[model samples]
Target: METSIPPPKRLKMLDATIKRHQYQQDALIEILHRASELFGYLELDLLLYIAHSLKLPPSRVYGVATFYHLFSLAPKGVHNCVVCIGTACYVKGAQVILTCLEKSIQIRAGETTPDGQISLTTARCLGACGIAPAVVFDGTVLGHQNPELVSERIQGWLQNGTN
Candidate 1:
């Protein structure tokens, strides 16, 4: 089941921007980005708010969101881990690494931990394919990962209050 997320004050600011621009259709992506930045992810209500304020259909807004890989529909945890699965990383066993992470964290891809400590996800590429099997934690990239090493690193981070 999905939980309700209150509309953040940032949505009001986005609304103003949309209105100021006379609700330009071209601004949809920017508006959605701003909303995601404010709320951590695009909640359903927030998407509807943007659609209503911009006079666009919610389906169009959702399509734009899903078309781009950056937008997340679910709430993110305090620490976000994005593992790259591009061709370079995949050949280096990135999929195995992700499975290990799921075992350790008990949450599958795109799911947050029960304690809200971490969210695990996969990306097509982090643009660091040279460093195959790359993983990003809170914007810091750690490349050339071994599955065992990745688990240890996550444990260390949680233990050290990095989460």
Candidate 2:
């Protein structure tokens, strides 16, 4: 998916960054941030390269990446949508909202639209059960969401590029 940037070129960039950071093990998170920013996602190849570059085990790199919600392993679309599927949210029609989103965006859960404009994701819980049926567009959480309002907000993002 990162075909736009050649792997060798990315490695070269990583090498420079590692050298600049002095390859300190503590810079792992910063290195990861750089890698993610450069490549748009942290693929295994990128993580392995980072570990090798930093003289750390691949597992450590992966552990850090997976531990933080700020990091994403999969490529994201221009816009991100994470629907809550926790029990409380589900009971409040979160699944209906998700289904409507899938239909409207023409992408199933865990997928980005063909146009690369929308990524549909699911979270077991957003810890906003009090609001139930929450949807996060980009990074802002919308509580008490219904299908119509979610669709309207998505349309707004499609038209305006912000939510």
Local accuracy of candidate 1 as per-residue lDDT tens digits, 54-146: 889999998998767678898777788888989999999999999999998899988888877788989988899888889997889999898
Per-residue lDDT of candidate 2, residues 1-163 (tens digit): 3568887797788788899999999999998988887788899988998888888999999999987665788888889889999999999999999999988888898888777788888887889999998999888998999999999988997897644
RMSD of each: 3.7, 4.0
Instruction: State candidate 2's TM-score.
Output: 0.70
Candidate 2 at 21: error in angstroms?
Answer: 8.8
> How far off is model 2, as Cα RMSD?
4.0
TM-score per model over all chains: 0.87, 0.70
Off by over 4 Å in 2: 1-31, 54-69, 160-163
Cα displacement (angstroms), candidate 2, residue 148, comes to 1.2
Clashing pairs in 1: none
